[model samples]
Target: MSSLHDRHRAVIPDWITLYYKDPLELTHGEGRHVWDAEGNRYLDFFGGILTTMTAHALPEVTKAIADQAARMIHSSTLYLNRPMVELAERIAALSGIPDARVFFTTSGTEANDTALLLATTYRRSNQILAMRNSYHGRSFSTVGITGNRAWSPTGLSPLQTLYVHGGVRTRGPYAQYTDERFVDACVADLEDLLGQTRAGVAALIAEPIQGVGGFTSPPDGLYAAFRRVLDRHGILWIADEVQTGWGRTGEHFWGWQAHGQAGPPDILTFAKGIGNGMSIGGVVARAEIMNCLDANSISTFGGSPVTMAAGLANLAYLLEHDLQGNARRVGGLLLERLRAVAAGVDAVREVRGRGLMIGIELTEPGTDRPAPDAASTALEAARSGGLLIGKGGGHNTTALRIAPPLSLTVAEAEEGAAILEQALGSI
Candidate 1:
């Protein structure tokens, strides 16, 4: 093992997983590629788990951070922060909820935690409805709502969490049902669960596309159907858009837009790509829920000027370049190419996703069983071919995840796809 790898294993907790048999030490990146310490460059398909939304080493974001750092780095949430205010204004305007309020945090876990706090306080209950195969965050409360058994450790939780269905369409009991019928069944299941619960549920938190759950999703309007039920029961809906926000899906700016008929969610949580690698996370809620907490609270490192400036610049760059449109056009072509390549491969179970967020589920050759070994082999092979990808799934990490930077060019997509196809063949 390399000296650095041995040292990393000695210092970092084993639970903090690293990719590859030989853990890679990436020194820097530009555009859609990164170079390891050894000077080997690889096309980055995963984009640091979708955090590098725009591009690697984006000048706008870098300059923003540098400029802000040269001045005041932070004033905490105790004072009026200009950059924070500006960024919040942009987000509030974008949030569909009328009279929305924005709360910033350092990570998605904190954002979701704050959302849970607001929801539970507003409704006066700790009961929550969560989707099956969901992966929210790794906090005490967030993990309770995270339905993926692989991620959730210990069954104990502060709040009562009920796991719902319809997140994964092809592998569940309802896999054979038509889209409309599947949604109806999940909704009925939700209502039945509601009937069984004695206390009022605080909220229903879900990721539109299950990111760590192998990028799985129910039918387009499944959440909309759930929203209708939530309205009747006075339960709030929280969209965990950590991975699906910022037009990554191409069709919608926010993942909940796929369920637009039910209107905007009562609350929304975002992280990952918003700051383009700068640590930023937040919760957006209407006045009622946001104002529910009677006591004042503060996040010391929440809205640091440097991160806010980074977010502002990143948002501007994304909107100006219409990166969402690029994700659509380029991602569409990439998916088509990948699907064609997978057609002749038996180990590939499915190719599904939208825009830059795509997933390739692997199975034993000519069989439906999840082939995690195949996925691992393919990941190593992809890296060997100078491509970096990610793998995740509730079912033993059996899916190859391909989510490139939103600024991914057609040529880059083609290159990544070619490398991935060869990797699959090698597996």
Candidate 2:
């Protein structure tokens, strides 16, 4: 009989990448570990691209899913959904936008698409500003604004997008500048770009931390500075918090809080961790922007009872247990430990990130050139040592991504760090 991998290869699209040369099929998970099909357990560091906000097989979330499924699987937006309304109320209260309104979708891509629709229609322009090295989503409309070439599949787009600087801090032309100077230069660039564009540019959409672009981000106040410039031009600011929301960043509940001087964004798009592995994504905006549409809009399965139950339970667990505080404590230690380990490895060009989202950038020893091979070798080595991690980068996939669940314990962090240290030594 043909192997499962062979069967997958025959049916699945070639562009859907797998992690290993011989990919391991996950069978089950509990807490911070997952067992492969062959029954080999490995420490899970990437948390399925940071979608699992809490521990794997969390009882609260699992029970909520089961109970909801027993009662009702789904109800379209045409009908009243108690669970959906309750969850939306919670999210709206949490969102800093005044007079907030919420709209649900099944994934981050759909959420961003909705945000784009609202911004473009409300502002009466298809022109947009996107940060360089940013990854929004896989949909056609989103791919147009994605500044990362590796992730963006085509040039054709419904909207006109202008790429901005200041997303990546270490390798750009302004890398050598101080944080203040870097922010100033980027603001100046934005000013110049707006000067050349039409007066009706719709909005500026950006991720608080670029997730697929190797977890890169600008200085703390970069977005605040940009917000000031945007206010002058009447441009809406959309914060894509798919990977950085729900206290994954440790110090802040939302990544945009790191740039809190400007208050909340005009629009916020979130997904991934909110449902704790359940498919729940949404857009939050002020009443005016969200209600701008002249016609009716609804998501058939977006606010399904099952997913809403999962989200409510997951969010409640996250808050009740103070997982954000746990993330701050545990992630701080892990970051320090990883930085120490990277300091001894010549291939590690930089270790950058905040909270639970961290990246280790690999380069040729004693040089600035990207070392994708080194990253690959280290990934395999770490897997061999019974640890599962992830790799990403705009520069040829040369960065290792480490984003464990927010509920990870300190002991788990130490163990993963040790395995990573061994893997780096091999590289």
Candidate 3:
């Protein structure tokens, strides 16, 4: 029989990439560790691309899923779904947006798609403002607005998207400016771009931190500054919190909170962590904007009972245990440890992030050029040392992404950091 990897390659799209030169099939997981097909245990630092919010095989989420499945697996949005309504109620109350309304989807892509539909319909325009070095989703509509050329496969788009500045703080044209000046420069650029665009631009959608673009983020209050300019033109602001939501950033519950001077965004999209490993995505917006559609829209599996239960239980566990505090405490130590490690390694360019979402950028020694090869080496080395991490960047995947479950312990963080240090040493 052919190997599972070979079988996968034969059936799956070639563009669907897998990690590692020699892939290892993960069989099961618990807490912050997972076992491979051969029963090799490894510390899971990436948390399945930051989707596992609390931990693998979390009892709360598992029981919720089981109990809900035994009752009713799914009921389309046409009927009154109690679980969906309950989850929505919790999310709305948590969301800072006034008169907030929620709509669920199966994945982040669909959530973002729904958000775009709402924004475009409410504003009556298809022109969108997106930040450079950003990755929203994989769907045609989301792809069109994505500014990262590496991920964007085509120029054809349903919406006319204009890329904005300030999503990336380290290597952009305004990188030399101080934090305050950087905000001023980016806001001025946004104003200038708005002047050049046609009237009635739909919305400006952005990630508080660019996840796929190697966890990059703008200076705090940058969006608040942009919000002032956007208000003048009546363009909506959509914060895509898919990867940075639910206290992943530690200092703030929502990534947009860092830019709270102008208040909550007009719209917000979230996914990845809320349901742990289960598929759950949603959009939250003000009532007027959410209810703007003249026609009806429903997601058959968007708010499925099982997924909602998982989300609710996962969210409860996250809050009740104060995983955000854990992320802040443990992540701070990990960040400091990694920085010290990077300081000793010449190929390591920079270590940046907050909470459990940290990134280690690799570059050619003594030069600013991205060293994707070095990143690959580090990845393999980490795996060999019984740890699993992820790699992503704007310049050909040159940064290592380290986002363990929010429940990550200090001892686990120390172990992961030590393995990462050894990996960097190998590179």
Candidate 1 C-alpha lDDT tens digits along 1-427: 5599888878999899899988899999999999999999999999999999999999999999999999989799999999999999999998798999999998998999999999999999999999989999999999999999999887888999998889999988899999999999999999999999998999999999999999999989999999989999999999999999999999889999998998999999999999999999999999888999999799899989999999999999999999999998999999999999999889998999999999999998877888988888999999999999999999543899999999999999999989988999987
Query: Residues 252-370, candidate 2, lDDT per residue (tens digit)?
Result: 99999999998999999999998988999999999999999999777899999999999999999999999989989999999999999999999999999988999999999988888
Model 3 vs. true fold: TM: 0.99
| lDDT of each residue in 311-340, candidate 3, tens digit only | 999999999999989888998999999999
Q: How many backbone collisions does model 3 have?
A: 0
TM-score of each: 0.99, 0.99, 0.99
lDDT winner between 1 and 2, please give it.
Answer: 2
The alpha-carbon lDDT assigned to residue 39 of candidate 3 equals 92
Cα lDDT, model 1, residue 236: 96
Global Cα RMSD, each model: 1.0, 0.8, 0.8
Ranking by lDDT: 2, 1, 3
Model 1 segments beyond 4 Å from truth?
Answer: none
